[model samples]
Target: MAQDTARQAPPTAPATPARALLPLILPALVVGVGASLLLLLVNGVAERLQDLLWTNLPDALGVGRYSVLWMLVMLTATGVLVGLVVWKVPGHAGPDPATLSLHAVPLPPVVLPGLLLATVLMLAGGPSLGPENPIIVVNVGLALWLGHRLVPGLPGGVWGMLAESATIGALFGTPVAAALVISEALAGRPLKGALWDNVFAPLVAAAAGALTTALVAHPALDLGLPPLGRPDWGDLLAALVIAPVAGLVGLCAVYAFPYVHGGFRRLGHPMLALPAGGLVLGLLAALGGHLTLFKGLAEAAELARNPQGNSAGRLAVLAVVKVAALLVAASSGFRGGRIFPSVFIGVALGLCAHACVPAVDPALGVAAGVLGLLLAITRQAWVSLFTAAVIVASPTVLAVLCIASLPTWLLVTGRPQMQLREDGSPVR
Candidate 1:
């Protein structure tokens, strides 16, 4: 710890000679490579594990109906893992909100391991969360500790640049909107480097991160890139309405979720809570049937590919079932992320919207609605914009989604809202 502090301690000189800078640069590269390797290894192993757990576990359990009882088992275990993480990890599971934005970097290194473990469990188990959150947790966490210990007094701006670049780099396969997100977050703060340096660091880091992710994650990593095309007036107006609706729903989620979930947390025992929530999910599945489990992208995609076969309002029920299950999983403290659930919400929203205007395409509607929610709630314009554009193959669909997203942003921003968390405390 003392050695780390000494490394981070700043010298009186404002600018270190290029020669002096090399030492810091070399170590940073080493750390970057090491972190990248960890990411790859973790991702590859997790993918295989996920498939094994998600696919083979059910059969092994003799749950002949393909019921997601296995998911329940996985979630329950991860729940315990996350509970331990929150207990031992200093910042508590993944990135804090401030750290989530650019203003903050990784948590101090002393507690980074638990966060990494919690993140791994989240993926291996099946929370709706994504690689992005955990990736940031590990990367930024390492960067912050290294910058503090090894590169101290090197200039806060330089550390910030490194952390930010690392984050941007990790999102390589996806339309991470790194440049755009970074630009938006750093709108006010002034970094130490010149314009070129500022841009170059994140670009390189993001490229490296993406490459590393691809090597590890393989076929799973897709940026959802869209072809460039102009959308019409209708698309723009649709976007305006869509964005606000998504925001409203997101706010509702951010709000009502706690009240709804607090009921379960009150149970106070993982043993009781997991079984109880599992029972509830099982019941909902029996009632809602088929829709009560994970959005199961492959399942949703299959349904989309064969829309005509779905009669009996199956899509609608599936949407509601997902909403219920996701809320339960999160509210009950089951370990997982929200993006997977949110994707279902977006898809459901699209299914409904498609019915409204026969003129607007179904695929287009799905793309637009999903992006709308992403924009409204996440405040991540680039991420949502890219997500909306990429999921489908058609250029026309992409154009519509992009145009529609503009209005959705306006709608979400216009609302007055409060966030709801399971702990009964208001989310700041």
Candidate 2:
């Protein structure tokens, strides 16, 4: 007992670099591989289930894929199903998802099954959220539990950092995205040494996770937008105007999210609140059509592929309905992340801008639009910039986006976040 206590006692100074390196590397690799495999399983099952729900059953029923009646019925049923899990399942699926951020304290191991089940239902049933939060929580919990047993001396928050980094890396299909996100998150905090010293292990884990997903599952974050040839003054002007417009659109939803969340929580039971949210989401889906379904990645691709096919008015409706769907799913008893849907919302806004003007460069408009929405929703500059730029897949507009994001940041900086306060109060 004395030896164990002494091992945990505060050191006179930080460990030497040589000693720190191996300790960081080995655990990161283990956690990274574990996280990667878990995410793969979650995504795989969800995809198969989605195919069954939206494809096989509908075909068997002779119903059209986007039929309003079918979607309405299926979504509400999903709500009942997931609500049962949330209410009756052990661990109650951890905590209210609306109160969670991209990262949070590790949940207990017992929470894993119910959380994953609820998440799969949300995804397969066509909620506007993504697998990010649920999957991250799973990874964090597993990593913490494993790390404690295997590497008792690792610093606090190290496993969480690794889990978050690995998840981001897997989701976006790149270690660099995780690095940028972590850098933005860690920017203002007190530091003990060079940033890279702390970041190195997580980066290693992120790379492993990113590479594993790419090699095994075929990474899917790309938007496949047309390339921008060169920068022009017209593009610059459009970015300055359009990015903030997207930010404004996102801010509107951000403001509404907490209120909606609080209202649902007042019901005081997942069984009641989730079905109600599902019904409203179904109604919104009926209004917005099938394009509003899912996490928005595939639909965003569809939108980008044929911008000319959708009228400007249609694009605007898509953005609004998606924002509404996102809020409803998140505030209800659904378990998921906000980033993927936010990307879809940003794409809709950008496409709307381009459709309305028919003058702004398409690629530039899409990139700027994403930049603004990500900035407003995440309040993380590096993440917003990287996400926007990567989707556009061009270097020409990065400078303009950087400049455009500055003003948008001001608009979102002090504003209320989308997550609810723990006391069940609205953010505002």
All candidates: TM-score: 0.74, 0.94
Judge candidate 1 at residue 418 and give its lDDT.
29
Local accuracy by lDDT, each model:
0.57, 0.87
Give the runs in model 2 whose Cα sits over 4 Å from its true position. Answer: 1-16, 426-428
Residue-wise lDDT of candidate 1 within 304-338, one digit each (tens)?
A: 56434454266667666666666666566443445
On lDDT, the candidate that comes out on top is 2
User: Which 10 successive residues of model 2 have the least lDDT summed?
Assistant: 11-20
The segments of candidate 1 whose C-alpha lies over 4 angstroms from its true place after superposition are 1-36, 68-74, 77-105, 172-176, 191-196, 219-243, 261-304, 307-312, 334-336, 355-358, 393-402, 414-428
Least lDDT summed over 10 consecutive residues: which range in candidate 1?
Answer: 95-104
Each prediction's RMSD over C-alphas, in Å, is 8.4, 6.0
For model 1, the local distance difference test gives: 0.57
- Candidate 2 accuracy as TM-score: 0.94
User: Can you write out model 2's per-residue Cα lDDT over 70-111, one digit (the tens) per residue?
Assistant: 989889988999999999999988899888888766888999
